[model samples]
Every structure is written in structure tokens, then in C-alpha cells.
Target chain A: MFYRTSGQFKTSYTADMALFPVRQDAILLAIILAFAWVILPLTASEFAFQTLLIPILIYSLAAMGLNILTGYAGQLSLGTAAFMGVGAYACYKLVTIMPWMNPVVAILLSGVFSAGVGVAFGIPSLRIKGFYLAIATLAAQFFLVWLFEKWAWLYNYNASGAIQVPTLQMFGVTVAGPTASSHVQYYVVLGIVSLMTILCINLTRGTLGRTWKATRDMDIAAELIGINLMKSKLTAFAISSYIVGVSGALFVFMWRGAAEPNLFDIPLSFRILFIAIIGGLGSILGNYLGAILIVGLPVILNTLPETFGIPISSATVEHLNIMIVGALIVFFLIIEPHGLARLWALIREKLVIWPFPH
Target chain B: MDFLNSLLVQPFADMFAAPDFLMQVLWEGLVSGILYALIALGFVLIFRSSRIFNFAQGIMVVFAALTLVGFHEMGVPAWISVILSLGVMFVLAVSIERVVLRPLVGQPDIILFMATIGITLFLIGFGELIFGGENKIMITEELGIPTGEFIFEPFGGFLLLEQKDVTAVVVAAVLVIALLAFLNKTRMGRAIRALGDDHQAALSVGISLQTIWVLVWFIAGIIALVTGIAWGARAGVSFALEVIAYKALPVLMLGGLESITGAIIGGLMIGLFEKLFEIYWGQPLLGGNTETWFAFVLALFVLLFRPQGLFGERIIERV
Candidate 1:
């Protein structure tokens, strides 16, 4: 009832084909943008902006990357965290070693590195599918993490074996560093995430995206229809890894500011995969929704107990938070396997016919 | 010749030079193999019947061990604690079957796999809540499992074997025999095989899938208990044991998901190979710590050779 889209009409093809055809949606999105840009900077606490919002934006981007390969392409990849690690480490080395290079170019080049690695690992998909492919990808996850840890040259022989994000500035404005404010970091992540999200949506809706869908649905049928399985699968891997890599770069540089090999372990991969699953797999908007649930739930779970004046230990809360998230995953899968995106669509459908139960 | 003698020849020469050490390594690998086989068996049972991989089987091992130790700490008699732990596992199986599996009956394989992950998270939380997030030593002696060591002097070197290791092998052998008999000779076992062979056909034959699912999960629970006890005795009961459970994953990959004998053989091979690699090749060449990924890499090579695994049925793609 609150979501009624009644009386909204479009005449031109361009108008009809607008990202959000409804004027109300456009207005709503504009308000959201205004809040993010103007109000959030003024209102949100430093901790909230840095920890909650920035991490969510960065992880949502990574989840979006995994969604392209796993959700849309029907490949079950467990190496997302590894690919993200590749991007983060590559960006770190490139920017620090080549002091004159632009940060954005370093980040993009890091993504290219990840894309190359992703395609190499994705080659096994030609002979394997489903669980077999998932297992094969695990090799990538373990091997890459081990490489990062053992190869002292990668970390420039740091004794601690961890990477520190160098202070980066763009256009004389500090984008990342101790001097940068929480709002600046948040806005930078928000900008990159938004741009990537738009690009992802465009790519998934284009001809290449249809090829991915066809391959996912029925590879044999897709091949029968003259779709090149190798080309389509490799493209999905390359593009998906590129997105994941950029997200990883942004995550470390903009959010974490430091990282260890432990940060890119299998559990991290599982966490990203969980976000993709809980958030709808194929929908662009579901990435944000899923990220919110996966990343926000623990915070809310931790805080809600305190709000009720309960004195639960933080560890207990962490455990309970895991339980609740797990329960929700099972609940969502059972209730609607399509994930939170389908629920949104269902609500929109009902809204279109609200006030009269037809 | 010196390089080859030191690098390659010394390891094998050392093995044969000390028959006692060779026997000890074989026994240690066999014991570890039994535990790995137990975990792999739980996964195999569920996969055979439902074709759904239960990734939470590792957590269940931790949960079962934690429950036994928790009850024992509460002053329950050793025998009573054992019974109580089994009851706890049974309740967990029933609840999981009803809550997670029942609702996700017809869902896609990946979705079901994810739900098992949810089950994993829930079990982690639930286990921690009950047992606290700390390691606890297994009461192997109190539970009537042996703790003494057997020493042998062969090839002029002393070799020691834990009594618990011998006990593990015997118990695993007995359990395997019992499980094999039950699977082949029992009516329910045939029904389970039928269900695994074809779900719809079994349903048409009036086989109660819900009953079989509960039964299989219950059996898996029992397997978890034995695995927990054995593994907990070796390494204290903690979430870190879940890492060891990962070793079972490569075992499954090499053995195939649905084959019992395959799991056993694959477990033994991985156990022996990983240990040998870490001791001889990994320590000398890579400076050790290769055990973590050696099994997975081996499984990767095996998959490249035979995607169906060592004993898995030939996979015939329909389309």
C-alpha cells in the first residue's frame, strides 16, 4: 500500500527505458543521493561512516563481482577472496613502488592482474561443472593465499608479512590516509561503488550478459545455438574477477587500510558468497541489500542486546549473531530461493495493484 | 650423487633402515586415516541418499565432542555422558532434518549446500553457547579408551605407538563392518540404496524419505561422535579441528562423494601422502607446513585424471 506506483506514465521510448521508469523511484533515489552526499557527512558519526558504511560499500562491490560469476554464470567459485587479495596486493605494490602513478590507474591495473589469474583458474570450467568446479576453485583460494604469505618479494620483504595502505591523494584532496576524514573515505567508496554498480548493471543487461545467462541455464543448448562456451565462460571469469579485484583494492585502501593473508582466507570467500546468496544472485540492487543484511546483522545483533539492558558478552553476541545469520540463510532459501531481490519484486508487484484486491 | 642421496635417498633409506619408525608412521597414518574416514563417511551417507553435500559435518564433529565433554564436566557418569551425547546428536539430527532439510526438499543443489553452511554457522554458535569458546581435553581414559604407549626396538631405534591409536583402528574396522552389514543386509539399507539410485522411483515404492533422512542423519551423528572422540583425544576439542576436517574434503574429492570404500581408501592415501610429504619433501624443500595444501593439490591432480574420483561411478552427462 505504501509502495503504490499508480498514475505514473511514460510516452517516449527513452523515458520508458529509463533506469527507474517511475518518477517516484527517481525522486526517491535523488533523496537517497542527497542524504548520502549532504546529510550523511553532517550527521553520521566517524565510526559509523568508516566502519559500517565504507566496509558495506566495498564488500557489496566484491559481492557484486562474485554474483556475476556464480549467480549469473552458474559457476560456483570459492576463490573470490583470493582474487580480491590479488587486486589489493597488486594495487598496493603498484602505487607504492611507482610513486608517480595515479591511484585510480593503479587500482584498474590491479583488476587486470586479477582478471588474468581468474581466467587461468577458470579454464578448468571447460571440463568441470557444479561441485567439481567449486572444488577446483578451492585450489586457487589456498594456492594464492599461500603465495601471498610465502613470497617475501610480494610484501617487499616486510618482516610482519602484512601490507600497509600508503597514504593516497587525488587532485590535492587526501582520499586515503590518516589525514583523511571519515566522510571523505565514505564518499570516495560510495562514488567508486556507485560507478561500478552502474557498469555492472549495463554489462549484465547487454549481449554478453545474455550469453552468460544462456550458458548458465543450459550450456549444451547454448553451445548448440552457436554460443562459444569457452569465450562466454572466460569473459565471465575475466569481468567478474576484474570487478572483485577493484572491490578488493577499494576495501583495503579505503576501508581496512591494512591487511594480512588471513584477511583473504576461505572464510572471507565464504562470507562474500553468502552475501551473494542472501542478496539475490542476478539482480544488481540485491548486492546492496545482501551486503546490508550480512554486514549489518552482526552490528544490530550486538547492539540490540545492549539496548534491552542485557549484559551479554561480546563473544556470546558474536556466536548468536552467527546463529541468526545462519538461520536466516536457511530461512531465506526455504521461503524464497531467489533471495531478497525476489521479495522486493513481489512487494513491487503487489504495490502496482494496491487498494483493490484483484 | 650426494644431492640425490641426501634429498631423495636419505628419506627412503631412513624408512627402511628403521623398521620400527616405518611401522610407527604407518600406524599413525592409519589412525589419522580412520578419523578422516569417519568424517568422510558422514558426508558420503548424506550425499548418497540426498545428493546434497553436508558441509556442516565437520562442525557436527566439534559439537558432538563438545557435548560429551560438557556433560562429563557437569558430573555425568562416563557411560551416562556418552548416552547423553548421543541423545544430543540425535536431537540435532532430528531438528536439522525437520527445520532445514524438510523445507528445502526440492531446492537446487547449491541452495541446499548453502543451507548446510547456515547449519554450520548455527552449530558453531550453538556449540559455543553451550560449551564456551575454549578448548577442552577429551576424557579418553575416563571413557575407557586406552592411553598407554607401546614401544618397540627394531633396526636399533626406538619407536612408540599410542594405545589410543591401536584402539582407533580396531574400532573403525568394527564400525565399518557393522555399517556395511547394515547397508547391505537391512531392509532400510536397501530402501536407502533405492532412494539414492532414484529418488522418484523410491518415492513411488512408498519409501519414507523423511524417515530415511532422519536415519541417515542420526547415523552421521553417531559417526561424528566416534570421530570427535578419536580426534579430540589427539587434539583437544576445539574449532581448530575443523581445519583437520578440511582434510576430509580432498579425501571426498579423490574418493568420490557417494562411495564408502572410496572414502576409506582416499582417507588412507591422503593421510599417508600428506604426512610423508610434510616429513620428507615439504620440510626439506619448502621449509615445512605443506600438509595444509598438499592433500588438496593431490586431489586436484586426481580430479584432472579421473573426474569421477577413484571409486565413483562413471559420470555420464545426459545432455
Candidate 2:
């Protein structure tokens, strides 16, 4: 079988512990990165780069962040969009107040701000579990959105009550804002997304990750075994929020270039949750897969009908898109609740067996 | 006495000073509460039987209302349209049971919940496709529901009450009583309670899961219809109604997901309290739109105090 890993051998622990242990995987990743950097910029239109690629990268980052807390830690959070809003607003304020500061640092600091808020909201998890915790998180969603709406200072008292992203430059090269080249913005987002993905993979494979899994699988047993519930849970929240916060910064600063409180409302939160579910919870690769399906499918639906000359109205297409996504979610849950990641894994397994019967 | 009356008691004093106004506000809150209770009832029925949170209940309300209006727009008689809408809801319930629920029988609670979200999205799309995605006025008068008003003069001031408001409250009360009786007296009702209590045990006792699911879903559909009509009569039938349906989420949180009585009590309390707060404090301090989130904040506090809610059975976790 072309997919067989039988010949793969590791001579050292470092090799075994590499992010992609298989040489084929490493090569495939390199090719993917090369294609993204060299080919996509040359071929992709401005709309494709801005709408399709940028948003997917941003949401994948957010979904990965959520994967750490809700997927790995077994917490149900409905405040993801709120946390992202915090990051976006915080970054906006930071960049405005200190024009000399680097934009990347501003983005990281914004994540720290979201982490603080995440811990405060996550405290309720100590007392509640399951749906109760989900409701508690909703409080954070409503409260944060309300605070942003009423607190004029957050938006710098813009007459329209929306935050506009200023042009971002690093080393005199425009990195963000309307004037920034699509290729520059794409590289910036791609760079951040890649780093975050590496960090998430490292964190999830470490001792802290084990503690999370332990807590998720059995909290009482975890406690007996010396895992501090508060510490582990809060840490998960902090890291998760930090990742999501960065995504928010990128979403507004790089993708949308403007933001309003309603832009990060409950529907956005639900959409991210759907992305996580359809992608496969807990799997790192599943985040990207889920984002592509959930975010990309509508675009595909719109284009495919046109290509076929079906003459569907845009409104009807939008409706049918929603129905198909809904039907797919139900179908996925019924057939493979583990998500598309599981389906891919199954295909790989079958390929490994080749022509031989099991 | 003047200071106390102005600060502490004037709000109620003002209400009584114009008895008609007090009656008007109270009637408005009551009618709104009944509609909220109807939506909450749909949610409670599904949760009671399946233990799955039906996020689509609000969409179902919109869908039912849209179907009725869509039928009317097609030259169907109002009475026939009502029957057709009911039939559509029945078909919806049966298809959902067969296609969505049956396949997802043994899934985790969260997955089932997510599937309902899928159902919600599908219904939203389907509703818009069929009904043309525009607001439609409720045919209240044509449906033989009164649109007359009653005026009361108290303390030399007049209060106006719509006859529709009166009808809504009375109908809701009768529906609640009928539901309570059905739940307590019927064989199917017993089976539903048993299923909610323990699925495996109910299966052991020979309850058909499919039949019970269909019946509960039918009941929920009926509740959705009633809610759609009542709410549509107030705000017109449109997707915007989905936002009002979200008002029921806070009610469910305060009432507990599994309790019908809690849904009723919580709906009324939130309805009355949010209106009162918006009028008295919200307008004065926060510029009045606080009604949007005041009930949710209240529910959040209630959850902090009593996670099981007023009528919910206490949950005991093992290990």
C-alpha cells in the first residue's frame, strides 16, 4: 500500500518525538507550505485571498484554541466569540495608544488580556458541569458584548461605535490594513497560524495535556491522583483564550479591517462551535478540516450551481446551503460523531492494508 | 412619606394612580409571558422525553407561522390553511424522528443537541424558501380571534387592553391545564415520564421509543403553532421572531430544562420582571434596551444560587 508506514524507523527519541514523525508527512507539509506561499499568491484573486483564505485561517486558529479547552478539557464554553472580541478590541486600543509598538506584540498582549478574562469566567466551572457550565459561559458572552457596546472608550468613541483597523507596518513594510498587499497579509496570517498550530501541538503532547485528559476522563479520579482541578482547568482556559484572542486580532485587523459588537455576537460563537463539531473535536488536524467544510461549503454551493447552469437564485441557494449544512451535521453525528478526521483516518487505515483482506 | 413614595413606592404608586395603565402593562406582560411559556413548553416536552435540548423550538415557531401564512397567501381558506399547517408539522415530526432522531438514538447528549441545531438551520432555510423570507401579518381577525380593546378608568385615568391579549391568556391557561391532565392521566404520558426518568428502564418495560418520541414531538409542534400564532399576532411572522424566542432561553435556564411547571413560572416571572426593569430602571440608567439581556442576567444569578432551578429535581452526581 502506498500509505504503509512499515519501513519508518527512528534512530533517536528526537526523531520519534518530531511533530511529523513520518518523513512522507514532513515532505507533504513542506509541499503544502510551498504551494501556499508561492503558487496561491500568483493565482488566487483578491477576493479569494481576502474572504476565503484569511477567514479560514483565522477561524482555524480560533477552533484550535477552543479544541484545547472544550475538546481536550471537556468543558463546554459558549463565550469564544466574546474572548475573541476582547482580543480585537484590546489590540485596537493598544495599537492606537502606542503607535511605535510592533503590531505582532500588540496582538500577543491582546491575547494576554483575553486570557485574564477567560480565567475569571472559567471560575464558574469549579461549581458546575455540563449544560450548567455552558449556561454560565453564556453569561460571559452577554456581559462582554454588553460591556463593549456601552463602554465607548473601547471603540475610542468612534461616532459609529465601530473599531477600524489602522494600517500596520513592520520594518517599513505594510503588513495589514486596506492598503496592504493581499500576499503580505496572507503571509502574516499564515505565519501566525503555523506558529500557533505548532504551539498547540506541543502543548497538547506535554504533561499539562495529560493532566487535561485526566481531568476530562474522570475528575474525581484525577483529583485523587493529585491533579489540581482549579490549576488545570484555569490553565486550559488561559491557553485556549490566548489562541482565540490572537485569532480575533487577526480577524478584525487582517480580515475584516473593521469590527462592531454585533460582528462577534452569539451567531459567530455558534458558528465556531459548529466548526469544531464538524471538524472533529480534540484532533488538531480536524480543526482545519472543519473550518474548510463549514466555511468553504457555502462558497462552493454558490459556485457549483452557477457552473452547472442551474439558474438558482442567490437567496434560494443560501437557503439550500443552510439546509445542506444542517443535514450534513446531523448526518455526521449519526454516522461518525468523531468527525471528518475520523473518516480520513479510516481511509488511511484501509490504504495501509492495500489489496489484502483483513 | 413623599421621598419614600417617589423613590421606593412611586413606580407602583404611579401604576395605581393610573389603574388603567397598570392594567395595560400587566396585561401586556401576561400575554407576552403566555407566548414565552408556549415556546418553553415545546422545549420542555422534547427535553422531558429525549433529554436533548431542542434549540430548534424557536425556529419551529417561525416555521409553523410561516407555513400558515404561506398557505393563506396561496388562496387557501384560513381554516383549511390552519389544518394544512398542522399536517405539515406532523410530517415534520415524523420525518425528524425517522431521519434525524432514529439514526442518532444512542449518541451523546451534546451530539444530539448539535443535531438539533442542524435541524434548526434546515428549518430556517426551508421556511424562508417556502415563505419568501419576508414578514407576514398574522390573520388574527380573519382567524376569528378578536382585535377589540377594553378601556378601564381608574384613579381618573384610562387603561386600554386588547381583546387579543385576553384571548391569549385564556387559551394558554386552558392549554396548560389540558397538557397537565394529559401528562398525569394518559398511558402515553406515563410512558413519556418513564422514558425521561430512565431510557433503558422504559425499554425494559416495553415502551416503544419511536412512538413516544413521535407523540412528544407532535405535542411540541402544537405548542410551536400556538406560540407562532400568539407571537405573530404581536410582532408579525418573521425571522426576527427568532430573537424573541431567545428570550425563552433565559426562562429555561431559570426554570430548569426538565420542568414544565418551572417553564410556566419562570416565563411569567421573567416576562413581568424584565418589562418592569426596562421601564423603571433600564430607561433611567442604561437607556432602556437592557430588556434584551436583563432576563439572562437574572437567570445567570438564579443559576448561581440554585442550579437546578425552582421546580427542577435536584441532580446528584456520582463520583
Identify the leading candidate in terms of lDDT.
1
Per-residue CA lDDT of model 1 for A189-295, tens digit only, reads 78888888889888888899899999999999999999999999999999999999999998888888889988999889999998898888888878888898888
- Candidate 1 lDDT tens digits, B99-206: 999988898899999999999988888888878989999989898998999988876778898888788888888998999999999999999899999999999989
Would you estimate the TM-scores of all the predictions? Answer: 0.95, 0.95
Model 2, residue B276: C-alpha shift (Å):
1.5
DockQ of all predictions against the true structure, Cα-based: 0.70, 0.63
Residues A1-358, model 2: lDDT tens digits:
6666788998999998888876667787798888877888889999898768888889999999988998899898888999999999999999999988888889888999999999998887876677767867887887788888988999998899999999889989988778988788888889899999989988899999999999888888899999999999999999999999999999998888999998988888888998888888888888999998888988888899989999889999998988888888888888899888888889777877787847
DockQ-based CAPRI category assigned to the predicted complex of candidate 1: medium
Error of 1 at B111 (Å): 1.0
Pairs of colliding residues, candidate 1 = none
Model 1: per-residue Cα lDDT at residue A13: 92
Report the CA-based lDDT of candidate 1 relative to the real structure: 0.87
lDDT of 2 by residue, B10-87 (tens): 676665666666666766777787788889888888998998888899999999989988889899999899999999
